[model samples]
Target: MASPGAAAAPRRGHSPLLLAAALLLALAPSPTTAAGRGVARECTYTLRVKTSCASPAARTSDAVAVAFGDAYRNEAHAARLPTTSGSRALERCGTDTFRLSGP
Candidate 1:
């Protein structure tokens, strides 16, 4: 039986495992292509993306980014800038601003 004042904690070895995981993650490369040019970069710069329009077909399909970075594979949508015209054509798709300092 345990003592009344005694408390339990995780094993000390757990830290090493976590450190290893963090190291691996820091060294891992973001998913990209053979070109590696778009293999993602340290998200220190502000990517002000703008497009003329996005057809209805573009709604569900992958976005065609002309910027210099890896495609937003699974990043969350921050906001959508719809056109005042209220047509299929949109002024901007969406905006994602963040600091992604990683490979």
Candidate 2:
């Protein structure tokens, strides 16, 4: 029988296993890992005629193009200017700025 007030023996190799698990967890991918996936980014478009447009948060560059087209069309309509085609607007309105950030 164990003596009263005697300390229990340390478990064999338990600490190492715990430490390895901790390391694995630390090295594992996080819930917010980007992993080359696209994130919401802001992009500005500038047209040849000095018309400027800003897009809403977009996940990919292609999405930015679509957003730009929509914004440009609305702005042009409001300004009583002719709306350009999506491809034409994209070609004319070169990207002024594009910034990437994590989710």
Candidate 3:
């Protein structure tokens, strides 16, 4: 027989599994977030003139250069320019002027 005035046992803390799951969720990266940790898409800048551009793909410089050539051609056509010519490089985004090559 049980005692009539006995107290109940204390509640236990959260389970280890639950805690681990929660920690994993908190540390997981969100798919919707933009990835800018490494190299980011930057606009190309030339001799104090900035142009809309992107860098060549890693380990595929030739292919990327060719792709950028097409892009530049399209841009020129849209701008009603006769032709476009320049070198590929990394530059800041949203910049309008091309930066000088050296100091």
Among these predictions, the greatest TM-score belongs to 1
Model 2 has an lDDT value of: 0.28
Query: Residue 36: error of model 2 in Å?
Result: 4.2
Where model 2 places Cα greater than 4 Å from the true spot, the runs are 1-36, 50-103
Q: Give one digit per residue, the lDDT tens place, for model 2 in 6-50.
A: 988755632121110010111223455454565432322323222
Tell me which of candidates 1 and 2 scores higher on TM-score.
Answer: 1
- Which ranges of candidate 1 are over 4 A from the true structure? 1-43, 54-60, 63-98
Q: Order of candidates by lDDT, top first?
A: 1, 2, 3
Tens-digit per-residue lDDT, 56-89, candidate 3: 2221112111111223232211121112335333
C-alpha lDDT of all candidate models, in order: 0.32, 0.28, 0.25
Compute the lDDT of residue 50 as modeled in candidate 1: 32
Q: Please identify which of the two predictions, 1 or 3, would achieve the higher lDDT against the true structure.
A: 1
The Cα error of candidate 2 at residue 93, in Å, is: 20
lDDT, residue 49, model 3: 23
Task: RMSD for all candidates, in order, please.
Answer: 18.4, 25.8, 24.9
Kindly list the per-residue Cα lDDT of model 1 for residues 1-103, writing each as its tens digit. Answer: 7798988654553212111001112223434433356544432333343332332223322222222323554232224322234343322354323222333
| lDDT of model 3 at position 28 | 27
